[model samples]
Each structure stands twice: as structure tokens, then as C-alpha cells.
Target chain A: MRSLPPLSIFVFALSLLIACSHEQDATAGSPGAVDVTAAWARPSLPPHENSAAFFVVHNRTDHAVQLLGASTSRAGVTELHHMEMDGDRMRMRRVPSFTIPAHGELVLEPGSNHLMFFELPAPWVDGEKVDLHLEFDSLPAVDVLAEVRPL
Target chain B: MKWACLGLLLVSLGCSDSDAGLLDFQGIGGDFTLTDEQGQKFSLAEHRGQVYLLFFGFTHCPDVCPTTLVELQEVFQRLGGAGQDLQILFVSVDPERDTPELLASYLQPFDLPVIGLTGTVSQVEKVAQAYGAFFEKVALDSAAVYTMDHSTRSYLIDGEGKVRYIFRYKDEPERIAQIVRKLLP
Candidate 1:
């Protein structure tokens, strides 16, 4: 029997490590599900301190995942908003739920859909972080850190 | 003698009249170089002869970016022959993810002269800052997970490669078309 070469052994070990790590990532049940990143609260004016948080979410798996609901201690309610333009008028509407398909991406971008946190119990200062409880279907519940920024 | 004097005065006045608009940077467009869809180097000065409508966005911005481009295409089509003298440029704010290949494929849906421009972070910063573009990278603490907050302004460039105006994201293409008519000679 011949002993394996060091180079070949190293390559084989590396590939196995990569595959194992990838598999471990799937244990979260999201397959390749990911929620929005670096989402934060935007400061607002008086009367209506309503502000939106923006982020990016991706689904790495081959199956579709739905974003069912989101909750935050900072506000009384959280909503998924989609900015729409009908004819020449621009408006924002609430969506029942946002969906992310396998190998697909969803962005909570400005001038588009966003996570709206309405009427914060208190105003947020610059550099403050808030905790958000985000719930996803078929994936683990995730806690998000929402940073505060000037309007 | 009177006719000769009048002719000379008119000639001098005509020579002195310059395009004051170009001399002033109205919309404040900065200069940069990035690869075009055809894999050729594209610089602002190279497109000097045409009016340009530039947007800083990523193809991944599913709704806003595509919707704006569609409206812009209609505006260009409305221009008819005037569109010939016009160029619509899409400069991706997410260069790390938006490659030349993706940009090319992404822009195929729009029927206009859509050029995608992207470069390194510093290079993109110079152009974005000059045009008042704002983008912030959101770090999620997860490996390889981040989001970008980019400026949502659509820049308008005149024939001289200078920024002429800026429109809000929701600005109607018809309003833009109205402006295009008076912009060209």
C-alpha cells in the first residue's frame, strides 16, 4: 500500500472542512435563509416620528422562505411597507408578508419596501442600538440590532 | 460705412457669446472611469457630446432601480430622435456585488443607452460624493452578510459632462421628457 501525498491529503482535508461547514450552516433550518443586515432606526421629526429601517436579506437554499412577521421593543408595531406609484402618484402600502426564494435576495431599500417602525415610544439618539425580534417561517427566530441614525 | 460698422459689431458680439450653462456645473457631476457593458473603458469626457441621465443603484435593488429605469426608457422613447443625442447611464453603487457581467445582463431589459459604471471603493466614493450620493454599508456581524445604504438621487448630465439637474426617485418620466425637449438645441 502506498502512503498518500501531503499535498493531496491537504486538498482533501480542506474540501471536507468546507463541506462540513456548509452543512453546519444549514442546521438553522433556513437552508440558505438570511434576514436583513445592519438594519437601524432612522431619526424623525415631531408629530410623527415614524421611521423606516433598511437592510438586505438573502436565501441561499433551493427552497422558498417566507418572512412572516417582525417585532421590536422600540415601537408599538412593525410593518412591511412597499412603496408604490400608481399613474403619477407615489404611495406606501403594507404587505401581508414578504417572501424570499431559494438563491434569491430581498432588499429593504429606500424608495422601495422597508421595515417601518412607527411612533417609537421614545426618540432614539445617534449611535444607540435597539433590539428587534424578527420571526421567520421555516427558520430560527433571529434577534437584530437596530442602530439609530439621524433623519 | 454705416453698414460695415454694423456688420463688424454683430460679428464681434456673436463671437463673444458663450454657452454659460456649460461653464457652470449645475448638477455637480464628478468625473470617473469604469468598464462599460461592451467591456470597454468609459470615461465621462468621452461622452461629452450627449446629454446623460445617470443613476447610482444596484441591479439587486429589485423594484426601485428597475422601475426607475423603465420610466426612464419611456422618457427616452418619447424623445424620439432627441433620444439619439441622449445617453442613460446606470452606475452601480454596489460594485462588490454588481459585476460588469451582471450589469450587462441586468440592463438588457431597458431599451436605451444604459451604461454600467463601477470601480473600487475610493473611486466610487469620489464620484458619489461629487454628485451628493450617499451609501452606507450595514454590517450584520454575520460572515459575508452586509447591506448598503446608497443615495437615491438620479443625476442629470448635460452635453458637456457636467451635472445639470437632479430628480427625486418618484419624478415622473413625462416631466423629465418635458425638460428634455428644451434642453437640446
Candidate 2:
């Protein structure tokens, strides 16, 4: 068997270290492990006191992830809400948590599950961007920037 | 016999070139007096020659109410100049919270010709009952103490103030505009 050169051995060892670190990152539950996409919120009119934000949470991990809640400086209170149709009537209720299955996604959209913002400090205007801090059951909190769009 | 066959075919297909194809909701709607956003008494009988779209909702409803109004704005945009003949009557089911001023402010964002209507609890109840609309206040544990759950249908009244058709929740805006156009002069 032939032995490799000193330079070749050093480069091979560095590549191995980088590969191991990348694998470690995949299991560390970093913000990059989970993805939040299509984040947008509705523009709020005066005296309405409330608005809603929608997005899709994609979990790439091997285990199911639970989304506990979210917070934003734009509103005094933020809660998870689901809108359901009972016959011809529409009902909105608070939800405790949403679980995203392994490699699955949870979609929050209009007329469905969403993040309800109550007691808005100021009305959300079209083209305004709002920062949201999302908390999870196990992973580190993720920060998202949602755009305000007219309904 | 050929003419008789053509008549049967038309009847089976429900083919019509006029308002004969429109749904008849004759018994569902009637005249009701409510306070408009300007704090003036608004009687349905007063707007006899104009088309009206009536919707039951509240100002604090975060999702459906605004979504419906925005859809109405799109409908108006589709209608263009003809939309001026159409008036939207937004009846507030949450009489305790949705004052005339609040309804006015909430509806200001939508550029459509909208009349925000609110009245006393009993008055609102009477109007809702006349149209078979259902609405109730639901309590919550959050800072926003309660929310209103209401029917999500839009009643389309023709120029003569007769309920001609009912638009379900999230109906296509283009279709609504098309139906409303048929009602215009």
C-alpha cells in the first residue's frame, strides 16, 4: 500500500471535521432546522383592536415538533386561533398548541388556523413589516418577519 | 311538436336570458330600520331604487369580517362605475361594542360604498330574525374578553329591495359582480 502525502492527509482530516460538525448541526435543533415560509399579516383598520397573521411551518426533523405560542411587540397579546364553520356560522376559538409531524408542515391561512393579535399598539398598514418571535416546545425560539398585506 | 320539444329542453336546462335564472329568496328579507354610521336613521324602504348587499358582522371580528369586506372591495372594482348603484349594508350584530363611530372607522379602509349599521340589541335581533341570520357573543379568557359568531352569508337585494340571491362565505368576487351587474339598470 502507498502512503498519502502530508498535504493530502491534512486536507482529508479537515474535510472530515467539517462533515462531522455539519451532522451535529442537523441534530442541534437550530433555527435553520425548521422553516417558516409565506409569512404575512392582514392590515388593521382603526378601532378594530385585532388582526391576524398567517404562515406555514415546515419541520425537517425526524421527530414531531410542537409550536407552543408566539409573541410580537406590535400587539398586546398573541394567541393561536382556529376558525371553524359550524353550519352557516363561522366560529373562531383559541387553540393551545399545534403539532407538526416529522417532515410535515402546518399551514396557517385565512379562514383557517392563524395567529390572532389582540390590542394592536398601532394599526398595521400595508407594506409594514412585523417581527414575530415564535416559541417551540423543544427547539430554540425562531424569529420571523411578516409583511402586512391588505386583505 | 318541434316547438313543444324546444320548450321542454329549455325548461329542463333552466335556460333564461334574463333575471328568470336568479334564485328567488322572496320570504327571506324585508325592510328593517337601523342606525347608519352617520348616526342617522336608515330605513331599507328609503333605498328602494338602489341595489344593496347586506352582511352581518362586527368590528372586532379579526378574520372573516375584514376578509368579506375586502372581497366586496374587489367586487366593486370589478363592477367599476356600475358599482356606485350598489350599496353595502354592514349590520353590526355586536351592538354593545360596535358603536356607529367604531363601525365607521372600521369600514373606512374599504373604498366601497358601505353603510355601517348598528342599533340596540333588540333592534338588531329583530333585523337578524327577519333575514334568518344568526349571531351570538362568545366569551374568551384572553384580554379581548369576547367575540361574535355570526352567519357568513351575504344577501343580495335587487333594486326593488327584494332578496334575489344569497352569496355564501368566500364566494368568488367576479361571480358576485356578475350577479350584481344583472341587477343594475
Name the best candidate (by lDDT).
2
Tell me each candidate's TM-score: 0.51, 0.86
Against the true two-chain complex, what DockQ does each candidate achieve?
Answer: 0.03, 0.63
Query: Could you give the CAPRI-style class of model 2?
Result: medium
Off by over 4 Å in 2: A1-31, B1-18
Interface RMSD of each: 13.7, 1.0
Regions more than 4 Å wrong, model 1: A1-151, B1-27, B140-144
lDDT of 1 by residue, A1-151 (tens): 9999999999999999998888777666533357567687655323233456767777776778778778788777777767654433334556777888788877776666777766578865568887877677777777878787643
lDDT of 2 at A147: 99
DockQ computed for model 1 against the true two-chain complex using alpha carbons: 0.03
Q: Write the per-residue lDDT of candidate 2 for residues B22-108, one digit (tens) a residue.
A: 666535789999999989999999888888999999888878888899899999999999888899999999999889888888888
Positional deviation of residue B126's Cα in model 2 after best superposition, in angstroms = 1.3
lDDT accuracy of residue A12 in candidate 2: 99
